[model samples]
Target chain A: MADDIKILAFDVFGTVVDWHRSIMDEVRSMHLDVDADQFALAWRAGYMPAMQKVMSGELGWTLIDDLHRMILDDLLVRFGVTQLSEEQKRHLNKAWHRLGAWPDTVAGLRRLKQRYTICTLSNGNIGLLTNMAKQAGLPWDCVLSAEVFQKYKPDPATYLGVAKIFDVEPGQVMLVAAHQDDLAHARACGLKTAYIERPLEYGASQVKDVSPHPDNTFHARDLEQLAGLLRC
Target chain B: MADDIKILAFDVFGTVVDWHRSIMDEVRSMHLDVDADQFALAWRAGYMPAMQKVMSGELGWTLIDDLHRMILDDLLVRFGVTQLSEEQKRHLNKAWHRLGAWPDTVAGLRRLKQRYTICTLSNGNIGLLTNMAKQAGLPWDCVLSAEVFQKYKPDPATYLGVAKIFDVEPGQVMLVAAHQDDLAHARACGLKTAYIERPLEYGASQVKDVSPHPDNTFHARDLEQLAGLLRC
Candidate 1:
């Protein structure tokens, strides 16, 4: 069944790149008078709820860039940090574009590219993905995004849109992600699913659930493991 | 000034790749009992009118793959060619993905990529552009399409949308193309424009209008010349 997948749509934030560490490192470099790890968690904690606003029709179509800014503004106040100027706030908001790829990401993706069409299916806007790809040497055949569909992930359209764009059936495309919930949603939309474990996605302090879900077509410890399992 | 441009969005069909020769070669290789060059011309002549249908809302959104197929069907009948099988038709429709770039395309593009965010701003759909990039080794940072905007070339939205996606001012994005009208439209949208001369775009049987347009920001015989002018 894995061999039948023609395109592999990857979830970017945790699966292919380490957003938490990247964001925390950026904050640490700035020497903010706050717990960096906790700040990173606090910022990411708003991602889902922020997307939910658009998904649930509470907000009009919005890019993750806008949502990131909104969350950053609130987090700055909650962390008792001095207010950043417009230029500083803008630079901080673009931190998403500079996230470092996981160690296995580039090599694993290169291997997978030998067989299947690999691209990002992230909530990150096109600018973010393009810049990240350039910075991290991610060899994506294309950079797809939730912005393309004007719908965030977990929405059926986001998964189905990949198939539609590639002119392939849902079953012929696979969604590779670190989150079991993301795989479940892809599976619900009839896409093949692969879950990659990222234990330290949030931080080194908390234990993450890397348990496999029965519905997924493939699950592995990371993209490297996934590539090996796929016989890439 | 040319020095201000950060993103070089390309017009793919003629500027970068020799589409007429490619389509002619693909058609001739089939050994159809028809003039291949004439067939290629007839087929391409239908391109704008077909796109105009969608632009005028006479048709719903459609991919260039489908548009090309529609044009091919009419051309086959008009040229007194027998109908091809479903598989044959599908294979022929994908010839757009196999277009060979001009002599200087790769070297010039590599040079330009060093200084700018290089991407496709073509009328070709994503699948076609992605596959073409893979086939011809066109190293695009991302592939932008009229399909993404659901509007064809000369549409201001298509040009401005490139700026919006990259979060850059229109002046910072240059539209590089072989067509004067395309460059003129980009200029109208406030995008800097570089016009490349593809004298054989329509075929060597007739002279093409490669005359410089006063509104164009730069003019070159090919991408290599453009890169030289930009000092990339």
Candidate 2:
């Protein structure tokens, strides 16, 4: 399955970057009067529903950055944190742009990049991904996003778009993601899938299930292990 | 004019990569029964007319790779060089992906990237830019292309789209390119413009005029000089 894969498209949020920890740290640094873990989880939780709104045409062609701001506005009210000025609120919403990579992300990506064309196939906007990469030294060959296809994940377009962009068959592109549903969709679209275990993706209180799925072409504990498994 | 800049969007073909020399070298290596210089010039000469076809809606939206291949096929026939196999033709068409970076390209980009977000805003496709960056060690913070905008350079949409993607005002972005026409178009879209001198872009036999335009915010001999001018 790995032999034919020339491009490795990664899922960014939980797969490549430690978004939960990053947001929690940012909340702490800003001295926000709220539970960081809960705030991070709440913010992330709003993501899928907001994307669904776009997918359903309730919100027409909204960027992740805009969707994120919309979620932040509601969260600020629910969390009773009304102290921020507009500039502070905008900066806080841009926390996604300053996300920290997982411990092994940079090194593993550097190794994997030597062999495969490594890129981000994330729902994050281009600016978010680009800034995150620069801050975290992600070393992506390309930064592709839902913004590029104007369609979020689970849409066949996002998965197949990677192959189309590279002028290769879908089989030659591999989706390396932590989410089984994402992998399932990519597999259904005839792309190879690699499951990456991001157990602490939701922070210390929540340990995600890291069990192997039979459908995935490969599975590993983290990017480092994935690189080793790929013999990079 | 430079004070507000947050991103540096670049033109890739002749500005970042030595396409003419690279193509000439490839032609020589292939041992084609044609003059290397003539072959290189002929191939590049087809580029604008081909893009014009796409712009005029005669050919629909086509990727630069496909456009390059079409041009190569025509050149092979025009030069009476029909001995190449399909595989050879395909490989030769990908020479753009292997184009050599100008000597100071990587170092200069690295320096500029320290102070501003540096990205490609080229007519080349994503795959081509990504492959070229991987091969040439270009230190672009993001690999962007006309493929993302679905519009070529000099198009207002393409110039304005970079600012939109980065969520910045057009004035916050500086277009760094060798071509005055590209810079002029970018300036018209409210982007700051920096012109780099690429005297031999067409080859040593045909020197490109590198005279300064007063409308440009900055002008330099190369990327390294541009970096110095920006105090990066």
Candidate 3:
């Protein structure tokens, strides 16, 4: 099974990087008036719908950075946090770029790198992913984002783009993501899928049900276990 | 000067990797019935003209890998080297993916990476660049290619695209290359330029003139000296 896979395309936000905790930490450090958890969750909650607008042609092609900023601007008003200047808002919005990886991410990715080509398949723009990787020491062979394909994940184009980029069959590429929906989409696209158990992805208050599905090719608690399962 | 630059976008072929020597070595190892040096030079010489065809819209957007194979097929016919199977021809074309880095490349890149984002700004497609980096251990922060823009080098789009990817101003991103013409084009796009002297880029017989250019921000004998000059 390990020998059959040539590339492992990871979903970055919740699987590779602990975006919930990372964003929560940033919000806490900022001492914003709103609850840190709520702020973080609210910010992330806007992501999918925002991407949907672009996907539906309701919005012109905008980068994840711009979408993030737009969401942040609305959240600031909704949360009654009005003290930030433009520069402060910009810095706070770039918090996504400083996301720390999960505890096992760096080591697991390094282990996987020894065998399969490991890369980020995320909605994050190239700059955001590159900055996050540099900061968190995620050793990606390459960084592929919606910025590359101009279509966010769950889009067949983004899932299939990985295989096209490497000149391999879709089955030869495995999409490792915490979200079952993402993995299901990849599987539907004829790519193999690995479910990463990120129960705390939405924070401890909202633990996700990481129960294994029969459709997934593999399931692991984290990237370390994924590497082991893949025999990397 | 270094403080002003946020990214160092490198030209991979001659600046980071010694394609001439690497190709020559591969040709020699293959024991092809042709002059290895001439064969290596011929392969590289096909590169620019091929890219120009795509740039001119005479040919549709083509990945460097396909362009390389096209050129390789022509060379195999031109050099009267007909005794090769399809698999052997494919392997020969992938020699580009296995090119060795220059001695100073790894160390210099590590040092420079500490200060600024280091990425590839090359005409090579992502797969070729990613495979080459993985094989050669070129620790690039990101891989930016002509494939990303669907335009080859010397096109203002490729140079400007690097700045756009990093969300930096063109002047904040420096183009580092062994070829002055590439640097000049980058400069014309308002990008800072660093020229690395790779006199043997065309092989030992035809030494390249790597003289200092006044317009360049920095000029060094190699990446090692470039690192030292930048105080990295």
Leading candidate by TM-score? 3
Q: For model 1, how does the per-residue alpha-carbon lDDT over A1-232 read when each residue is reduced to its tens digit?
A: 8768999999999999999999999888877888999999999999899989988999999988999999999999999989567888788888999999999999999999888888899899999999999899898989999888888888899999999888889999999999988888888999999989999998897768888888889988888888999999
Q: Is candidate 1 or candidate 3 better by lDDT?
A: 3
lDDT values for all models: 0.90, 0.94, 0.93
Instruction: Give the Cα-based TM-score of candidate 1 against the true structure.
Output: 0.97
Candidate number with greatest lDDT: 2
Supply candidate 1's per-residue lDDT for A106.
95
Q: Pick the winner on DockQ between candidates 2 and 3.
A: 2
- Stretches of model 2 off by over 4 angstroms after superposition: none
Q: CAPRI verdict on model 3?
A: high
Residue runs of model 3 more than 4 Å from their true location after superposition: none
lDDT by residue (tens digit), candidate 2, B56-126? 99999999999999999999999999889999999999999999999999999999999999999999999
**Clashing residue pairs, candidate 2?**
none
**Candidate 2, residues A87-178: lDDT per residue as tens digits?**
99999999999999889999999999999999999999999999899999999999999888989998999999999999899999999999
Write model 1 residue lDDT over B184-219, tens digit each, in one string. 889988999999998989888866988998888899
Question: Residue A91 in candidate 1 has what lDDT?
Answer: 87
- Point out where model 1 deviates above 4 Å: none
Descending-lDDT candidate ranking: 2, 3, 1
**Which candidate, 1 or 2, would have the higher DockQ against the true structure?**
2
